[model samples]
Target: MAAKKSEYTCIKDNTIQNISRKTAELEARADYKDKRIDEINHNMEIMNNKLDQVLNSFNDLKLQSTSDDKELELRLKAIETKLAAQEKTTEDNKARSDRIIAIVSVILAALTFYFNYMH
Candidate 1:
């Protein structure tokens, strides 16, 4: 009976040692998981900051493009107005030249007919 009790005590001690080792392993694994979660959170924050910067740059480009387009449109309108005025002036000059040529030709013909009749 004394030998049997000693054997049982040895078995219980081995079981307790195994349990303590398993608990230590579990604690280490939990610590590693916590560290990994912290790293992931930090990386996410950095990515969010980069995303915000990209968004701001995109908005600035959009505004600049809109402003340039408006400026181009105004310049085109001004050119069109100038061209219309120039064309109207050209047409007016052409009509005046035609009238002057017609009047000069009629006067020359009349002068020729009078000189021939008088002679």
Candidate 2:
């Protein structure tokens, strides 16, 4: 009976040591997992910052593009207005010159007929 008791005691001691070693290993794994999570979180924050910068740049470009388009439209309108005015002026000058030429031709014809009849 005494020998049996000693054997049982030895078995119990071995079980306790095994349980302690397993617990230590689990703690070490938990620590490693915690460090990995921290690293992932830090990397995510950097990525988020970069994304924000990219978005801001895009917004700035959009605003600049809109401004440039407006300026181009204004310039085009000015040019069109100038061209219209020039065309109108040219038409008016041509009409005035035609009337002057018709009057001169009539006067010349009258002078020629009078001189020929007098001679």
After superposing candidate 1 on the true structure, give the runs of residues whose Cα lies further than 4 Å from its correct spot: 1-12, 111-119
TM-score of each: 0.74, 0.71
Instruction: Give each model's clash number.
Output: 0, 0
Cα lDDT of model 1 by residue, 3-99, tens digit: 5553434658878999999999999999999999999999999999999999999999999999999999999999999999999999998998998
- Model 1 vs. true fold: TM: 0.74
Taken over the whole model, the C-alpha lDDT of each candidate is 0.93, 0.93
After superposition, candidate 2 runs with Cα above 4 Å error: 1-8, 104-119
Of the candidates shown, which would achieve the greatest lDDT relative to the real structure? 2
Instruction: Give the RMSD in angstroms, all C-alphas superposed, for model 1.
Output: 3.8
In angstroms, how far off is 100's CA in candidate 1?
2.6
Task: Give lDDT tens digits, candidate 2, residues 35-108.
Answer: 99999999999999999999999999999999999999999999999999999999999999999999999998
The Cα error of candidate 1 at residue 19, in Å, is: 3.4
